[model samples]
Target chain A: MIAIDFLGAIGRLFLGFLQAIGTLSVFTANAVSHCVRPPFYFRSIGQQMLVIGYFSLPVVGLTAVFTGMVLALQIYEGSSRFNAESAVATIVVIGITRELGPVLAGLMVAGRVGAAMAAEIGTMRVTEQIDALTTLATNPFKYLVAPRLIAGTLMLPVLVLVADIIGVFGGYIIGTSKLGFNPATYLRNTADFLEAIDVITGLVKAAAFGFIVALMGCYHGYSSKGGAQGVGAATTNAVVSASILILAADYLITELFFSK
Target chain B: MAVDTRIPKVSLRDVHVAFGPKKVLQGFDLDVMPGESVVVIGGSGTGKSVMLKCLLGLVTPDRGSVKIDGQEVVGISDREREPILQKFGMLFQYAALFDSLSVWENVAFGLTQAKGMTREEAKPIALKKLAQVGLGADVAELSPAELSGGMKKRVGLARAIAIEPEIILFDEPTTGLDPIMGDVINDLIVACVKDLGATAISITHDMASARKIADRVAMLYQGKAIWQGPAATIDKSGNAYVDQFIHGRAEGPIQVEVRA
Candidate 1:
């Protein structure tokens, strides 16, 4: 009986996981469908862009700068043993443009924008504002979900571009001021090692991460029930799901782009 | 050829909806005439709100149909549902005002966003609707979060009527207010519905609110309308469930689910 009960519990857990994935898949398809359709809400899209992109810049920038600075320091320390400290500039630039810039920005925005969207939409759900929108002949997907998805997908690339520049600049500052390296030589090395594909991959990853963050936020909030506690749970679920998906998607996207 | 002109404003036919193991509504049927105020009264969790949601297409019944003006709304596409939904406005239990929007903006939401009217054009109409609900122009620019409970209800009512919807739904209109404020909201609802000659359906457990706003009363129990009559006759409904519910009795055929 104990063995059977344990098996049953495992079965239940597996089913729950499949169910959540199924629901989120359907939600993403519907939200994407709305994104490509006409009668597009330009104002709502613009507003969401401001929230998801503009409002998130400071945090993403701060994160990228710190990561770049730390990477330069660590690379310099490790390379000095082999008398290859000059490699710090190239490695920092390549790392920031190809991975750290997009990943860090995506995670930061997931925390800031994803949680906000979930909390805002969750509160609206509990209070029936979403229903109110329905009664007023407004489609909640078109009105609420689509704009955020579009903004998240489109703006994250731009944010990643900005973060890449800031991150490389951070490495430059650390290499020149802290490591006593010549600024011009470090800048030359950094620029020479960076490629268009490296930045493109990062931007693509940013876009995917943005989509995941918004999608998770909306899916959890739209399905939230109970009351304030439900909204709170939705917010937490959105952030956790978004962050996990961001990392998973980053790996998948990297495999797709760079696989041998 | 004679034309049949007496189409019910809203009708639910053999509706059944269940959430997992719990059945909220079963074989629920009701036909509301145009320009009538039909209030549904029942114990908490007896599907009063579910019935309303079904009519609005917010909740789809597992079986049966919801009709607006004798036009079947069940399984309709979003494009088809839009025109039907345009005819409805709702006042939610907690007013459900969009906290991000100003009071005037909230009232003007459907008009400007859904109806494609400019903000400049919709402002006067929103202000007029607000005034009709006894809200002053001074309150227009304030955010929904800043309003008192009674004031929020008034703003919600104003938003409901802003588009002059053919049907208005009130979901627990008096649930969270003081008795006097409740009565005030009730009176305002009556006045607004009367002036527009709109069909109104209200779901509430408050007997006093039912007496004030209802032209007719329906009592739901265990997923069915167990008793229904003119509002004046609710006190003498004679059904055991209705009696137990209205008088707030602990001992009756109706059982409260108390979990330890």
Candidate 2:
């Protein structure tokens, strides 16, 4: 009986996995169709940019600064054991630009903007505001989805660029002043080791991460069921799904950009 | 032969809508002639709102057709839908005001966003509409969150008429208001629809509102319109379902679903 129960559990898990994948595919299809439609809502895009990007700056900036400072200290300590303390500048620049900037930005946005989008839109769905928009001859997608998608895609790269600069600057301050490194040599090493591809790859990752975050937010929100409880679930699901997608996509993009 | 020659501003024929296995609307038929105010009344979950949504093209009927000004709406392209939509204004149950914008901004959203009117051009028109619904210019600068329930409904009414739409839909417009406020909203709805010479379709369980605002009243039950008649004749609709609803009797033809 225990064996039979275990087998049943396994079968249920498998079905659940398939159901999740199927739902995600349906969401992706709906988002694509909504994105391509007309009666584009430029105002929604601007509002989302204000909400998701501009308001998010202080937190993203602070996180990047601290992350850079810590990375420099850790790299300095680790390299000194191998008698290669001079590699601190290279590690800080490359690490911040290639991986940390985009990933952190994605995760932060998933927490801040993604959750907010899901909650707002999900509440609207539950309360029938989306239905109201439709009845008014307003395409909820063109009015709601397109703007968030466009704003998320466009603003993320700009945010990531700022994060990368702040992150590098944090490392420079810690490395030169605290670690007793020569400022000129640290600056020169940082410039020499980081290539255009590294920065460009991070920006590309930022854009992809932005798309995933916004799409998941809008999809879960638009399709949210029940009332308050359902909207809460959608918010949680949006953040989790967006965070996972961002990490997975970051890996693929990194491989594409750097792998021989 | 004598002809039924009145031109309907909106009409639906054999409309059927389903969500998966649950049929929300089934072979629903309705006609509202130009400048007529029609109220659809039913208990919760009886498809009154769904019928209204179908006519608005918000929920596409799976079978049959909806026509606005004699133009079939079900399968028309977006370009074909826009002009039809421009003829519509809707006041939702919860007001559905944009929380980010001030009251006037919400009222003028369609005007500024869809009609290409500058904020300066739209503000006075929005204020004028607000005044028509008895809101002062001081309320225009306040966000939706700050407004009382009655105020929000008035703002929604203002927004609905801002563009002078030829048709208006009111979904449970008096659901949460006090009796006095509800009467005020109903009177405002009647005045606006009359002033605009607009055909109106409203769904509500508020019989007081229905009596105050409707030229004709229809009762929906079990996914179909069970009875329809001129407002003066609703008391003698003769159908058991309609009698049960208007009289608020629990022991009549309408069965309340009590979960055991």
Candidate 3:
């Protein structure tokens, strides 16, 4: 009887997983359908771009710069043991552009934009603003979801590119001025080590991460139940889910791009 | 007063809404006439909001038909439903004003976006609506977050009437206001509906606001309309559920769920 119960529990868990996947697919399909049809809201799209992209630049930049500086110091200290201190520039450029830039930007956006989206939409759901939108002859998906998805997908690539450049420059500044490395050789090594594909891959990853972050945020927000507690839960879930998905997708994309 | 049956403005026949196994509304039937204000009063969990949502197509009834002007809305595509929706405006329970936009912008949102009016064309109309709700032009530029609770409610009312919709929905329009402010809002609601000659449906637990705003009142309990009559006859409703609700009596036919 105990074994049978255990098997039942496992089966229930498997079914729950499949149900979650099915629900997510349904949500994605609905969003896509709404996006393609309609009385398109270009004004909303532009406004969201300003909110998600322009307003987010300062924080993303600061994080990238500090991360780059810290990374340079760590790489320099580790390479010094092998008498390979000069390799600091190469590692810093490659690491920032190929990995850290997109990953960190995605995570930062998950915290900032994802939480904001979830909270705003979740509150709207609880307060019945979404219903009000429907009563006004406006499709909530077209008015709310499309602009957010578009903004996140389009803006993250630009943000990641900016972060990559600033991060690499930050490493260059720290390596040459603070660590007493020859500036010309540092710049030359950094340039020689980084390829176009590294940057392109990072940007591609940024776009995917952006979609995941926004999709999770909007989905949780749109489906939020209860009242204040529900909005709070949706906000938390959106941030956590976006962060986890970003990290997981980062690894998967990396494997696809660089696996042996 | 005899029931005037000249083609009811809104009608719900055998409406049923279920969230999986839990039935929120069951065989709910109602008919509201043109230019009439109907207030649906009920206990907290009795599906008053669900009924309103179903009427607006925000929640699909699993079984039944909702008709506006004798046009069947059940299973209608969103595209087919737009014109029906365009007749409606809603004042949400929390005043659900867009925090991102200023007061006037919120009022102007429907006119500019849904109606394709220019900002120039929308501003004066927005200001006029605000004035009707006793808000001034000076308050127009302030963000929704900056407003007091009563002010937000007034702003929400202004936004609802901005488009001059033929049907207006008020979901708990007086929930969070003081009695004096609640009366003020009720008065504004009456004035706005009268001015537009609009069919109005209000869901509220506030009996005072209901008496002031509704020409007729319906009591919803256990997923159905239990008692409905002229607002003046509520004191003599005779039904124990209606009696228990209006008097706020704890001990009666209704059971309040208290989880230990």
Of the candidates shown, which would achieve the greatest TM-score relative to the real structure? Answer: 1
lDDT of 3: 0.90
Shift of residue B98 alpha carbon in model 1, Å: 0.4
- Tell me the tens digit of each residue's lDDT in model 1 across B135-245: 999999999988999999999999999999999999999888999999999999999999999999999988999999999999888898888889998788788888898
Each prediction's number of clashing residue pairs: 0, 0, 0
List model 2 lDDT by residue over A52-145, tens digit each. 7899899899999999999999999999999999999999999999999999999999999999999999988987778757655567777888
Local accuracy of candidate 3 as per-residue lDDT tens digits, B97-161: 87778999899988987788999999999999999999899999999989999999999999889
Ordered from best to worst lDDT, the candidate numbers read: 1, 3, 2
> Which residue pairs overlap in candidate 1's backbone?
none
User: For all the predictions, what are the DockQ values?
Assistant: 0.81, 0.45, 0.63
lDDT for B154 in candidate 2 is 97
lDDT (C-alpha) at residue A112 in model 3: 95
- Candidate with better DockQ, 1 vs 2: 1
Supply candidate 3's per-residue lDDT for A55: 88
**Candidate 2: fraction of native contacts reproduced:** 0.39
Docking class of 3: medium
DockQ, Cα level, model 3:
0.63
TM-score of each: 0.96, 0.92, 0.90
